[model samples]
Target: MRLHEYEAEEIFSKYGINVPQGGLAKTTQEAVQIATNIGVPVVLKSQVLVGGRGKAGGVKIIDNLNDVERVVAEILKSEIKGFKPEGVLVLKKIEIKKEIYLGITIERTSGIPIIMLCSEGGVDIEEVAHRNPEKIFKLSVDTLQNLYSFQIINMVKKIGLTGKTLIGVVNTVFKLYQVFKKYDGLIAEINPLVITENHEIFCVDAVLEVDDSALFRHPELNKRKLNNMSERDKRLMEKGATFVKLDGNIGIICSGAGLAMTTMDLIKDYPSLAPANFLETGGGITSELMFDCMELVLEQPGLKAVLINLYGGINPIHEGAKGIAKIIREKKVNIPIVAKALGNRQEETWKTLEEAGVYVIKESETQKAVKFLSELLGVKK
Candidate 1:
């Protein structure tokens, strides 16, 4: 789960990391109050889940009460990356002499947590890595051992930071590592970790993503949930259907998570099939659940087609086919549906779907099924 900047900063401050004084505001009046409390010359940042808030005009600098009202009103009335800005974070603006980037993320290839630091900050790290790979320095930590002091010093030297700034950076890096380990975080990043003219370092911006699977262990983190879930997601959960929204035209429903993800990936390879959602109907799917899943997929405004990939593992293919047929008969769905039925009771499953006038692909190969679905959906190859 991704955290908003204010939430991440709160966690960072708990670990002895220095952050600017800030408070959250939900309205223009609240923003004005926060600015007044923190004193003027405050930074008003829109609190949204997505990035590039500054580019999206979600961030502003206000020197007084009038500017605070104007900036807050403008931000609250706009949306960034499709999410409507409902609140703003009011923080004390600070003078910066230099900027740097610091981040820690799990490395799949190394099988360990990796710390990434760069002198070129306030820009997307990925872009920096692609355009100037030499500017970024990376260090992988052994999960069994704590981050070493020498390693921190080496990173500071590699970034070309010296003197008091280097000492402060080293301490902040160790504290960040502690926060990552304690919270079971997937990513903890501070973009533009700035140095003031007086040689004090403070994390001016923060972003953290926690491991959803490990949330049960962190009750405090769980309580900080921002209720930013999408409307489609809430409806799917209420209807007892496992659904994950995606930017595509083809709606997919499968018996297992692995198979559903693979189906989406394969569809992407075809250049024609665009998966709308990742719907996994865990074993023994009832007709009602199947119907609910289909209805949820259809509710997507841009959905163009439906792909049903069922492999009999623990789920009986015959029962699943019956459910699909029932949904078609009852819902009167007009959209094209392509079904690939294989394993347990395949023959019966095919017969049931065929009887309902649904296009049943009899191929065992995923690529062939993808091609057929693409054609049916009018996806150009």
Candidate 2:
């Protein structure tokens, strides 16, 4: 549910936040036209989800039409952080007197939205926080009251804002907080919220990550999807399987989000194991859904083995085992599957797997399961 810069800017603009005029272009000619329309000294930015676009040569300054065409051609031809550049955002370049970073994200430990502001901008916020923690100001907003005016004013003052620009910064913070609450956003950020040479404040870059669970409430936001998903991802989604491809080779299928994440973390503990996807079948999933999930995992060419770790609380373990056996037999899948079933109906699940001649580890411990799966893949320890 991460949005592209243009998409995020559109949301920000709706909330009365100031953003530079820009348009998305799919071709070099279209990009050149957009630059010409926005006037000279435009910035050509690749609309990819990955970061470090400038370091990766996905961003360039176009002083004229020639630079526009040249830069657009280069950006469109480049790949940043493994994501192929598909489109370019041509935006009016501004003369910045200063750059600041402002963002809001859910705190994993506290389960609260934390607002972060820093005077250092135009760089990775994480790097800044890591190097100089004192410079970054953090405020946790109470979900009950949302963001208050005094809190916003305090944050701006902490960042040392002054004059009319201070008022603009305070207003932007208020508007951004409203947008975050309105959309049930997981994250909303404006990197390098810049002060122009004329003392006007504007968001130079924007990023928003809407909570996927909240998508049903916002039809308009749902339609504004960005083309950030990969070809395999699109295929998996179309097939009705909950799939999230990861950097590892071990394919994981669990019945809960907690278990799926735990499986991934356990795999990381072993040097030789890397999970390929975070596939959750969810509780009470039918045999058909199980078949779909298994098929999706097997579709990955790099998948070395499949791990089925289900603590069936609501779901009957026998049904899950039966589904796995059905998919394996019907699809003639060759990848090794290691099953670790626990919780209600565990005996029935083990019996079903044994009857089907599937590898049943009969372990409730996640670490032991990881060890067994790693060994099955010819990895020691």
Candidate 3:
């Protein structure tokens, strides 16, 4: 689950990472109070889960106390990317001598945690990496073992740091890594980790995302409401499934993220058809889980068709197919339900799906399965 900036900063601070003094405010009065207490020119940042807040007028500097109410009220009323502000973060603005980028995340291809540092900061790291690939320094870390201080010092030195400043930055990296490891984080980022004219380093912005599957281990996080998660996503998460809702009529249920994405892309090959959701069941599958998935997706309004793409592998997909069959019978679903069941016990899986009146595709190619569903739904070019 992704956290708001304030939440991330709180986690950072708790781990002994230097962060600017700030507090979360839910109203204009609270914002004004925070600014008054700081007694310095402060920045009011809208607390939303999405990015582009700075460009969207969700961030403002309050040099005068008189303007705090108006600025806070204006930001609170404005919506960014269809998401309203849950609150505003009031922080004392600092004079920055330098801005640096530091982040740690799992590298998908290598399946290793990669720590990245860049001299440039306060902007999208992707944009920087694409424009100036040489500027970004990377070190892939094995999370199973300890991250040595020398490793961080060596990487930081390449960026031209020296003396106390270098030591401060190195220490911050250590603290940030601790936060990442302790929280079961998918992403622990500090954009614009700043050095003030006073010669102190503070994480000016933070982005922490904990793995949803690992939430059960952190009860404090599991009970908190996630602003970025939709109700459907939450329901699926609770059921040990993950679903990404989309804006189309085809409901997609697949066994992997890659396959679900591929199915969505192929479904878009037909001009009038698009995926309604991307549902991934991961490795663990059961008849009851499949039944639950079908029931959830079928509840979506305007879903004209359902597509189930599965690869048996080590999973007893034939048994899971029983759940789909059960739900179909119970709901009396009439929409075109097309399934492409491949791999071990493919015949048994096909039989169970077919018995529930689902159109089973024998082709191993996903494109053909999508084309068949498109035609069945009478999708126009």
Candidate 4:
């Protein structure tokens, strides 16, 4: 789950990563008090889960003590991209000599955590990647081994840091890696990891995102509510399924997470076609489960079609097909439904789905099936 900057900075402080003095305030009075305690020339940052807080005017700087209350009140009243601020982070502003980017995240294809560092920072890394991909340097971490200081030094040296600065940067990066490993973090980032005028390093902006699936292991971190979880998400969680709603027209159901993601990516490949949701029914599929999954998918509004990508590795494809067909018949679903069911009892599954008027594809390539779904939605490209 994504963490507010205040919360992320708190975690960073515990790991010996330097961060500007800050406190979280939910009220204007509290914000004023924190600002007074920390002294003036403070930055008032809106504690919103979404990004673009600066562009949305959710962030403001107050140099005068009298302006703290007014700025805090203004920020508290504002929302960033439809997400209201939960609180305001009052931090003492520091002078920056240089800004660098440091981040660690699990790479999808390799399933290995990769550390990304760039000399250009204080902005979205994605923008930098697209505009100047060569500026970013990546190092894949072997989860089984410790992240050595030498490895971090080698990567950062190429960015042209040496002497005391190199030592400090290496130490900070190593500590950040420790924090990433200890918290089961999906993403731990320190944007604009700054070098102050005094030549001291500090994490000016922090972002820590713990893996939701691994939250059970960290009781303290797990206490925070899973932000923005819908009733549909809660229901799916209770039923041993994973579902992520998206803004699109195709409802996707797959037997595996990889397949579900692959299907979503392929649908996105076509112009004007996107997957409406990611629904993965992990092992032990049955007709009843299939029927329930279909009902859930159909409940979503603005869905123009449904795509089912299932593999019968250890699942009963024929039996699951019965449940899907049963639900479509009962609900009288008119939107196009396509199923690419492959594996054991494939022909039987095909017969059941086709008889229920659901288009069936017996091919191994999911792109072909996705193209067919795009055609049904009048978005084939």
Candidate 5:
């Protein structure tokens, strides 16, 4: 769940991180009131979930009270990347002497969190990484243990952060890490972390992304929309199923969480194969439940093929075969299927499915399911 800018700042402030004085405004009148309260020379930022707000004229700095209403009125009426402004963030504009970037995110391959520091800030980090990769410094931290003081010192030295500014930056990151861990966050950053002329360091911009799986730990965030979940998401959640929609032509239904995740990962290795979703049917799937899962997959748009991979352990292969065969026969569906029913009574399961004209693959042939599904979808390997 990505938090709104104002909300991120609010959460940061609770952990002793300094942020500009700001409030949310849904109307032009409310925006002017916030500016008046914070005093003039304030910045008005459009509070939309999408990016490129500044380029789209969603951000403006006003020094005069007369122009606050008119400028904010225009911003409120404008849209940024097809997203209408839910509100505008009214903040006291800070004069930045220097900008730095500090953030924590999980390294995909290593599956560990790392604190990243960059001297080049206020610009997209991705742009910096691509153009000036050496400018960014990284230090991987073990979440199970407390952060070492030496790690901070090493980062301070590596980034050339020195003196009072160095001292302040170290303390701020210490607190920011706590917020990151406490919330089961996926990524947290204070980009454009600024230094004022007076040598005071403040995080001018904040971003916090919490893992949806850990939302039960933070009840207060219930008000904030997580991934802007749609009706399909709501239904999947109700069924206690893990289904993440992806842009692809093949839809997958597998048993077991670990197996489903592995299947999706394997699918990525084949460029011709792309999965529409990660749907896992837990242990002991009933006929009705199996039908529900199949129906859900069929509803997905742009889907060209479906694969049912079952490693029958607790849920017998016969039950899964009966369920899928019933759907094919009753619905009279013509969509191609790649069913891999392994373990107990696998022979009988394949027989049942083959009678329904479903393409039955073997345990040894499971590895070729991706290529087969790709061909079913008419994608060149």
Candidate 6:
């Protein structure tokens, strides 16, 4: 699960990573009070999970008193990518002489934790890497072992650091790694991990995505749902279904992870066709549950089309078809839904979809299905 910047900053401090002084505020008055107490030169950040906050007017620096209340009020009411702010973080803005990026994430294929660092920070590291790969440095780390001093020195050198600055960065990286391992994090990152004119380094921004699978070991996180999940998501989770909303137009429903992922990948490759979510109905889900799942998928924001990619080797297509039919019979769906189901009773399944007026695509013609959906949406790539 992903964490808000404030929550991640709290975790950073707990792991001994220095961060700017700040507190979360839920109201304009609270923000004004906090800013008053902290003095001027504070930054107001939107607590939403989506990116491009700066461009969205979710981030503002208050160097003057007249703009403090106005900026905070604007931010508190702002929406970024269809997500309204829960609140604004009133953080002490730090003076930066330089910005650095440091992050540790698992290498998907290798299953090894890798430390990625770049002196070119403050901006999106992925964009930096895409435009200039040589600027980003990477090393795969064995989390089971302690970081060696030599390894820390190597990172410092690659980022062009020396003296006290090098020592501070080394310590920061060490603590950041500790936070990563302790939380079973998929990503523990500090963007614009800044260096002040005073020569002190502080993590000005943080983004942490924890391993949801490992949350069982961190019971507190499970109990609280990381305080990030919406009530709808929490209820869905209790039903053994997984749904993650994304900024896309196509709502995806499938039985297994691999099929759903592959379908999503194919759709992404197509111009103007993006998967809205990863909604896995799981194996042996009842028709009633499938009905509910589709209902939920239909309600998804920014959804223009639905794609049901099903393989019925173990999850019989007949039963899956029954669920799809249930949705057709009960729900009033305006969006076009296309499905590709195979196994158990292919003929019967195709008949079911045809009867429900659901379009069917051959399992071998996956790319064709994606193309059909893209054209059906009438959107530009």
* All candidates: TM-score: 0.75, 0.75, 0.72, 0.74, 0.68, 0.89
Query: By the lDDT metric, which is better: model 4 or model 6?
Result: 4
The best candidate in terms of lDDT: 3
Error of 5 at 360 (Å): 16
Residue 9 deviation, candidate 3, in Å? Answer: 0.5
lDDT values for all models: 0.83, 0.81, 0.87, 0.86, 0.80, 0.83
Q: Indicate the TM-score of model 1.
A: 0.75
lDDT of 1 by residue, 1-381 (tens): 778898899999999999998788999899888898888789889998777799989988887777898889899988875567658989999888899999999996676999999998789998999899999999999998878999999988998889998999999999999999998988999998998998898998998888766877987776554255455455545544566656577889987877887898888886645787789876466666676677777766556778898888656778777778887888787888888989888898899999987889998887788888777766666
**How do these models rank on TM-score, best leading?**
6, 1, 2, 4, 3, 5
Writing each residue's lDDT as its tens digit, candidate 6 over 1-381 gives 777898899989998888988789999888888888888899999998777889978898889866878888888777787788988999888988999899999998899999999988888887898898998988889767877878978977987898888889989998988889889998999998898877799999999988877889888777766466656566566667777667688899987877788889989886667888888876575566677678778876677789987777766677668878888777767678898887767788889888898889866667777777777776545
**Where is the poorest 10-residue window by lDDT in model 1?**
232-241
The alpha-carbon deviation from the true structure for residue 199 of candidate 6, after best TM-score superposition, in angstroms, is 1.5
True-vs-predicted CA distance for residue 273, candidate 1, Å = 11
Report the poorest 10 consecutive residues by lDDT, candidate 4. Answer: 225-234
User: Which portions of model 2 miss their true places by more than 4 Å?
Assistant: 77-82, 224-253, 261-279, 283-308, 313-362, 367-381
For model 4, what is the error of residue 322's alpha carbon versus the real structure, in angstroms, after optimal superposition? 14
Name the regions of candidate 4 deviating beyond 4 angstroms: 226-233, 243-255, 268-365, 368-381
Error of 5 at 11 (Å): 0.6
Whose TM-score is greatest here? 6
Q: Write candidate 5's Cα lDDT for 1-381 as tens digits.
A: 678788889999999999988799888888888888889798888887655678889889889978988988898888764457878899999988999999999888888888888998888898999899999999899877889877987787888878888888898888888889888888899988998998888887788888778888897785455346656556556666666555566789988777777777777667667777778976576666677778778776566678888887656778777878888887777779888778878888899889988888884555677667666766664
The predicted structure with the larger TM-score, 2 or 6, is: 6
Which pairs of residues clash in candidate 3, taking residues 3 or more apart in a chain or in different chains?
none
